[model samples]
Each structure stands twice: as C-alpha cells, then as structure tokens.
Target: MAAVGSPAIVEASFISRLVTRKTVMIGLLILVVVAVLAILAPWIAPYSPSRLSVVNRLKPPGGTYWFGTDEFGRDVFSRTIYAGRLSLLVGASVVAFAAVFGVTLGLVAGFFRRLDTPIARIIDAMMAFPDILLAIALVAALGPSLVTVIVALGIVYTPRLARIVRASTLVIRELPYVEAARALGVPTWRIMSRHVLRNLLSPILVQGTFIFAYAMLAEAGLSFLGLGVSPEIPTWGTMIAAGRQYIGQADWMTLFPGIAIILSVLSLQMVGDGFRDLLDPRLRKDL
Candidate 1:
C-alpha cells in the first residue's frame, strides 16, 4: 500500500470518496451513459432520427417503437438519443466561449486598476438583462441557427464567469506569492497566467458545470420558441415543440425528450455540486 500522500494513495482515496458519495456516483453514471449513447447514436439508434413512416404516426410506445412515433411518424427514441449530440455540443461550446472571454476580461479588470472600472461596468451591464431575454435579442439580430444560438448563449453567460473570476482575481493578486512575483519583475502575463489563472481554476471549473447545464436548457428553450436551429433538425426542444400539438394523443413524443433533458441537466448539477465540495478547501477535509 502506498503512503497517505503518495500518488497511488491519493488516487485510491479519490475513488473511495467518489464511490461513497451516492449522488455524485449516480450523476456520474447517468452522465457517462448519456454521453456514451450520444456518441454511439448513429449505430445505437434503431432508425434514422428523420426517417418518416406515415403508417406509424402517433403510435404509442411498444416493442416495435420503444418511445413511440411522433406526429411526423419519426422515431422518438432515435431522435431523443441523437438530440443529445447537439445538446452536449451546445453546452460545451458555450462553456468554452464563456470561459475564454470571461477569464480574459476578469484578469484584466482585477489586475489593472485603470481597466477595472470599465470592464466591471461592461460585465454588470451585460448581466443586467435577463439571460433568456438577452439571448433572444441576440438570436433575433444574428438570425436563428445553431451557431447563432451558441454565440447568443455564450455572450449572455460570459458575464457570470467574468464576475466570479474578477472577484477571485482581486483577492489572489494581492496574495504574498503574487506580490513576490511582482517584486521579482516577473512578466505581467506570466504572473497572471501562472499564478492568478491557476488559483482561479477551482471556481472556473465549478461554474463551468453549471454553465453547461444552463446552456443545454437554454438551447432547449430557444428551440422550443422556434428561435433556435431549424425544425428539421432533431433536437429535444424541437421534438417537444412538435409534440405539443398532439399532447393528448402522442404524449410520448414530448415525454422521452423532456426526460432526457431533465436527466442530463440534473446529472450535471449533481456533478457540479460534487466538484464544488471536492475542490473547496473548507469542504475537502470532510470528503
């Protein structure tokens, strides 16, 4: 057995904690399963998401049609499975976009007194608008499409990460190590990137998870409103929107996709909570 602080011991300890945490383990398992299913959708999905069968329209869930047929006679199960691809893609894209802009602005604002006021004001202004409203305005201006939705959501969410990063950077830049680095004439970029950026990772990571969930949900909302990707694409939101017309007769159409959305978002939230607990210095000992 390795010593307590050894790499192997630490790895084992992490695994122990992960297994002992029921919510985290469950969330992780669900996330893994969803990701795997999405990745393998082309093969795993019994039928093409868009394959239409007028003969099977509105069929309820059964052995032949797992999640049933939609109003368009398309496979609900296949569509829901495939929808994960776009949903996950949007979530990741938004997180990346938000982090890049948010981190840069935050670093500049916190490190440079002269730039702080302007950057902070901009961040505050962007955050003032409700996320959905801002996203809608942006998408309307940019023209509805996958890329537009991603960009709109990314812009809307960036301020959140920026605020968090700015607050953290303010405290971090004044720390003894940072002061020492400055005293030694370390390059500004190097000090900020190596010292400030590294320390801010914990909050960034925790916030990234929440942002991922938010992006997914926001995409769904946008699609539902017909302001997202074209209706032809098999997104969960589009599926739900299409099914709303047949609510009483074909509830399965919306049911499965909504469940997918719920599970994916819930799993992400639980995992985010777990990561927050694990990364927080005050909570690490309890874990």
Candidate 2:
C-alpha cells in the first residue's frame, strides 16, 4: 500500500520541483548578479560618480574610459554603477512598503466582510488613475525629494497590491482550513495571520518582485522629468535628462545609463516571471 504523505513531504516536493525548473534558476541567477552589482557599486566604480573632470568631457568609449564620459565629464561607467544602488534601493523600499501596507489592508478586508466594500471602492478609485500620473501628482504635492519619491511610488503601487492580495485572500478565506481555524475559536487576527497570510505568501512575493521593477522604472522616469531625486544625485534618469541635449554630439552619456536601467528592470521582470511560475499551484502540480 502507498504511504500517505505529510504536509512537510508535500512542501519539500514542491520546493524541489521549483528548484529544478530551468527558468526559475536562470532568473534567480540574473537577479543575483544584479543584486551583487548593486551591493558592490562603490568598490566596483572606476571613479566618483559625481566628480567632474572638465578636460575629459564628452569623450567616447576608449581605453581610458570604458563606457566613456558624460556631458559633465563624469565617468559613465562609475555613474551607472552608483545609480544601480539608488535604483535598487528605491525599488526594494517602495515594494516593501507597498506590500506590507497593502497586504494588511487586504487581509483585514477579506477577513472582515463589513470592510470589503469600502476598501474595494477606494482601491478602485486609486486604480482608475494612471500609475505615472498618480506618482507625479503625489510627488508634486509632497515636493521633490528621495523620501517623497519613494513614498509617492509606494502609494501609487499599493492599491494594485492590495487588490491582488484581496483576491487571493477571498479564495483562501473560503478554504476549509481557514474555516476550520475560525471555527476553533481562533481570533480573526490569528486566523488571518496564521492561516490566510501563510497561504498568500507565494502570490504576494511574486507581485512584490514585479512591483519592484515598476518602482525602479518609475523612479528613473521621475528623475528624468526633474521631479525625482535631487539633480546633485547621479541617478540614471537625471543622467539621461542631462545627456539629452548632447545626444547628437555625444551618445554615450544617455546610452550607458539608459542601458543600465533597461538591464536592471529586465532582470527584475525575468525574476518575477520565474517566481510567478514557480509559485503558481497549478504549475507546481504540473511540474
């Protein structure tokens, strides 16, 4: 006779399947490389990102300057590396803030049906606004600054995360396990925290990764538009903005930073896709 599998066995089998998936492994590798680069930016940078060398201004890629020089004669390679740190920081922070707040609201809404309608209406209203527009409006209201940008992005993204969490929680709330937990005199908070939240982790994580990518891109866009980090900061968007005037004469300034932004966002998106695939119950079952 076949032996009955325990929950631990089922979980282990799921994890093994996820690890064996080629796409997930490749995505993880890409994410790891980006993360390492972001962490080692200061050590890896060839020169001070903000330092100006008037003599070498607008130099094309060569032996002396691998990625060339920007309009202000800042090392393109160095700035790109340093910018990665800021971009990644903003992305991670915004996503984390949004996820925590959104997930909490979603859980509350799902567990307490009395609150669902109002929460759903609020989320719907927020969702009606375009993300970039909403971010810009929020930033404009809060005034331009690093903290403002992060907060703006976080708020703009939170509603979407809340919706995702709410949908997931709705399904989970109906599950027998959740109902049993509630029937056992488990407090609403306990039932939502222990039973519903644990089941929603995979989806929340996958959504958070995508949100991080969006946050990165949004930060770059805002910086380019002069509403992001201060001009003093060497952000990829600011670099692009400053370089646009010299695009016809010197392309490296814009090209290098633009490419860096693209690669970082692409890496995150790839990881998100892989994570979604790995986390989906149907996909895991099929694998």
Candidate 3:
C-alpha cells in the first residue's frame, strides 16, 4: 500500500469502497442493463410491440413467444422492453421539470425572507395531501395524457424538492461565504446561482434519484388505474391492467411486466441509498 493519505491510496480506497458496496454495484448493473434495453428497444425488440395475432393470443411462455403473448397476441417480451421507454421518459421528464421549478422556488424561499412565508405556506398546503391522491387529482383535472401525466407528477413532486432545497439554502445563506458575497453586493441571482446553488447540488442530486424512482412508480400507478397513457400504449402498468382479467389463464402477461417494474424501481431505490451514503459527510465518514 502507498503511504497513508497519498493520492494513489485515496483513489484506490475510493474504488475499493465502491466495489464493496454490493447494493450500489448490483443496482448500477441492473439499472445500466435496463437502460440499455430501453434505449435499444427499437432495434432489440424481436417483434412489433403493437402487432396483433388473434390465433396466437394468450399463448403461454414457450419456444416461439419467449415471455408469452398478451390478450391481443402482442408479444409480451417486446411490449415489456418498449414499455421501459415511457417509464424512463416520464421519470426523466419529471426530474427535469421538478428540478427546474423546484430549485427556483427553493432558492428564492430560502434566500429571500420576504417571499419565504408565502412560498413555505404554499408548499405546506400542497404537502398536506397524500402524494398519490394529489397526483390523481391533478391528472384528473388536467385530462389524462402523456403530457398531462408528466406535468401532474412534476407539480406534485416539486414541493418535496423545493422543501429540501429551502432547508439547505436557509442554512447555506447564513454561511460566511454567502454572507460575504452579499456584503460585497453580489447580484441576488448571481449569489443564489453561484454560491448557494453549487453547494446545494449534492442534496439535489440525491433527491433527484429518489424522485426519478417515484415518478416511475407514480406513472405506473396512474396507468394501472386507466388514467395514465392510453391503453394502446404498451406501458408496463397498462400491460398488467390489460392482463388482470386473464390472470389465471395467462399469468405470464402480468408476471413479466410486474417483474420489470419491480426491478426498475428497486434498482433506483438502491442507487439512491448508495448516493445518500456517499454524498452525506456523516455517512461518508462512517464508510
């Protein structure tokens, strides 16, 4: 081993810590595989996800249909792969939307005393409702559609990010560097963006991962309730919903898609936990 605290030793130790974190490593591997499959669905899927064949409908898993056929005789395997596209799309879109609006609200609320009460109250009122209930209400009012689902979920989750950011920003703004920047007459936007925002990234990133997972699960729940994307779309939730009627006869219909959702959500949770441990100073020191 190199001398204690040496750069090489530090680098190697970091890598060692990462490797030893089984949950993170496994989660990352699973996440990467799922992402790759989703991204390559157009080329990787063997048959059209929407193609129908009445004669082959509800076929059990066998040589011809790997994961079996759905009620419409659409290939479950293909649909499962294609379904990831929407799930991932919603997750990513929601993250982008939430982060942009949430971060702005948080920074302003934490840094500006005049606006804090109003913003904080608004956040508190929104959080008063259960997440799923609020999301369902938003989707219902917005008129369900891909865009609406994304927008609804984004709005529902924004407060969570905003609250986290506001709490951190409240503390950060009182830091010497931030106070010094203010004392020097730095522009409000510049101070928030440069000084406060940079320091806020670690929590933002960690929270973002959890939000990504929540978005995916929420999208699935909405779709399962027939309020998400149209049934014609092959989202995992839709697949399971469509298959529920034939559960006894065609178990594969729900089984494969259910597995997909579970794996994807679980992987995200594991990854988020890993990020929390790695990024939080107290947790990092313990490691």
Steric overlap count per candidate: 0, 0, 0
Scored by Cα lDDT, where does model 2 land? 0.87
Pairs with backbone N, CA or C atoms under 3 Å apart (clashes), candidate 2: none
Q: All models: lDDT?
A: 0.93, 0.87, 0.93
Please list the residue runs of candidate 3 whose C-alpha ends up more than 4 Å from where it truly belongs after superposition. 1-16
Model 1 clash pairs are none
State, as a TM-score between 0 and 1, how close model 1 is to the true structure: 0.95
Writing each residue's lDDT as its tens digit, candidate 2 over 1-287 gives 33459777768876787688777677677778767877898888878888899999999999888899987788988888788889989998999899888998888777779999999999999999999999999999999999999999999999988998899898899999888887888888788888889888888888898999899999999999999988988899999999899999888889988988887788777777777776786875565
Q: List the residue pairs that clash in candidate 3.
A: none
TM-score of each: 0.95, 0.93, 0.94
Give candidate 2 regions above 4 Å deviation. 1-16, 285-287
lDDT of 3 by residue, 1-287 (tens): 57999979967876788788999999989999999999999999989998999999999988889999988888999999999999999999999999999999999999999999999999999999998899999999989899999999999899999999999999999999988998999998999999999999889998999999999999999999989998888898988998899999999999999999999999999989987897788999897
Worst 10 residues of 2 by lDDT: 1-10
Please give, for residues 44-66, the per-residue lDDT of candidate 1 as tens digits: 99999989999999999999889
